[model samples]
Target: MTEISKISLRNLQKRFGEKVVLNGVDLDIAPGDSMVVIGSSGTGKSVMLKCILGLLRPDGGTIQLDGNDIGTLRQRERNALLRHVGMLFQGGALFDSLPVWENVSFGLLGAGGISRRDAKDHAIETLAKVELDAPTADLYPAELSGGMQKRVGLARAIAASPDIIFFDEPTTGLDPITADVINNLILERVQELGATTLTITHDMASVGKIASRVAMLHDGKIIWSGNASDIDRSDNPYLNQFIHGEAIGPMRPDVSTTMPKETY
Candidate 1:
């Protein structure tokens, strides 16, 4: 039997006044799969992600979750649908005022509508999933190392047992070893939940570690996609320049526009 897509986007279009960010983009993610989107900066990766998350309404096209049209949903319906989805922001995006458990349990408290007692229990359990001890939950975000902060974010993303997870630059701003730890933890947790995931990142290490399949976004569209192992075999100039980090590629990124060197 042909597997139906868990999430699908068709001819997606988004623009900011004179500048077009996503132009006629199309993609599909299968159930329990990890698909990482790789691109240079300003290539509309974030725009596409926002469109799907309903943070930014697309100027055109359709988003489908479980074959249902997302664009046509009511506010209440949207909220219900979104409860199945979770996100890890580029920054840890934790609340400094809140303790670690409260931050991890935010979505659980809101949409899951569980009591504080229950939410805290779940938060403690989820933190353990990310290899954080229970006492760590009582501490605040500011007290954690960058790697610990990221683990907390991952814990939050999986707190509600979401069927879909979004990872935005999952490995950014970390030492090589710490980044690898996060990547492994992400893979483990997502597999345990049997959730589908989409990650947008410039980090080649992340792409290799977390992606089952890879897609390249260039000039506001997905220019290429294939198995992660097949990335080096691609003849596409954009894909080649990006993966190899060659400065003199067809994209011709100038000094100010050059891609960030992979820190990890």
Candidate 2:
């Protein structure tokens, strides 16, 4: 049986003044697939994600969720669609003033109309899934370590059991072991929920552990996409250059390498 795509983008285009980003990009993600989009900093990866989330408007092209064109949705309709999405931002993006339980239950309280007691219970359950115990629920965001904070963020994102999740550089700042733990937690939780996910990260180790499929973004487009296992064998020069972190390849030379000549 063929799987149906849950999210599809066709000929997507976006620009900021003179800078063009997302030049006719196209992508398809089937339900329950973990797609990791890899790219160097300053590529349109985040922009593409923002477009999908309706945080930014694209100049052209179509973004469809379950065959519905979300790009054309009004603000209220778009927000309704976004209720199905859970996002774990690069920096965790937790509110410093809020306690851990409140942070975890943020969406539930705001959107789900869950009562405080019920929300707390749900928060505790979600926190347990992320390996966080109930004792930590009363602590503020500043009281937690980076790993713990990320766990809280994960708890918050999954609190409502959203059908789609977006992870932006989820493992970027953590140590290797912590990053691995977070990746495993993400995999486990996502599997448990059977949710579709799109993650953007430069961590190759993360790519190996979390992605069923990998797509590389370059020059405002998806340069390559395939099964995660096939990334090592990909012959695309851009992919080769990126994966190897090579300065000397088909990719443009770094502007920082040039220096002014000094006169004696």
Give the alpha carbon lDDT tens digit for every residue of 82-129 in model 2: 778899988999999899999999877888667899988888888999
For all the candidates, what are their Cα RMSDs to the real structure?
Answer: 4.2, 5.8
Model 2 residue 29 CA deviation (Å) reads: 0.5
When summed lDDT is taken over every stretch of 10 residues in candidate 2, the lowest stretch is 255-264
Q: Stretches of candidate 1 above 4 Å error?
A: 1-3, 254-264
Clashes of 1: 0
Every model's TM-score: 0.93, 0.92
Model 1 TM-score, 2 decimals:
0.93
Per residue, candidate 1 scores C-alpha lDDT tens digits across 14-97 of: 877667778888888888889999998888888788889988889999988877688999999988888888899889899999
Instruction: State the lDDT at 81 in candidate 2.
Output: 77
Worst 10 residues of 1 by lDDT: 255-264
Superposition error at 54 for model 1 (Å): 0.5
Best by lDDT: 1
Q: What does the lDDT come to for candidate 2?
A: 0.88
